[model samples]
Target: MGKTTRDRLLQTLASAFELPEDVVLDLTRITITGNTQFLMENHRGILAYDPEKISLRTDQGETVITGRNLKIDSLFASEIMITGSINGIQFIRSRG
Candidate 1:
């Protein structure tokens, strides 16, 4: 298949799995709507990296996470590592 076709196919698959395009392309970081944050390293998805204050938004409510020094390690493609204390996590969905 062509590069464009292949890219589209990969994007479709990634979206279906709630993954971002950067993750598939082995990018550095993938931020969705500035709400959902994803750190890419290898080929895995690690959620809740922030420890001091991690927030996530959904259509219903939000999640707050609290801990300590929040950080992501070995982030390359779809793999990420979170360190420090998990302060809180929040989830909020945007209405359009």
Candidate 2:
């Protein structure tokens, strides 16, 4: 019903079931290779995109990618593949 409640529930269930935090919380997953490729799974949607930056929404919160010549090589409902000279990645969690 609320952030504290939900978080407590997740923690309780996770500990009781011996489940990973991500699996128990239903969070997004990210994969990166070198500095040229990026992939995200369980993404909600894209928030912003440009040659130098891209922002995406996820179940956990928002993710921002910054770099040069960034391009979305492939996109799916729940997954995205990006290619470029990735300079940085940031994850922003929503405040309760």
Q: How many backbone clashes does candidate 1 have?
A: 34
Q: Give the range of the ten consecutive residues with the poorest summed lDDT in model 1.
A: 30-39
TM-score of each: 0.31, 0.85
Estimate the Cα RMSD of every predicted model relative to the unseen true structure.
Answer: 10.4, 1.7
Stretches of candidate 1 exceeding 4 Å from the true structure: 1-51, 54-65
lDDT of 1 by residue, 1-96 (tens): 386587778878998998876658443342322323433233333334345665433222334445566655445443444555443344444343
lDDT of each candidate versus the true structure:
0.47, 0.91
Candidate 2 similarity to native, TM-score: 0.85
Provide the global lDDT of candidate 1 against the true structure.
0.47
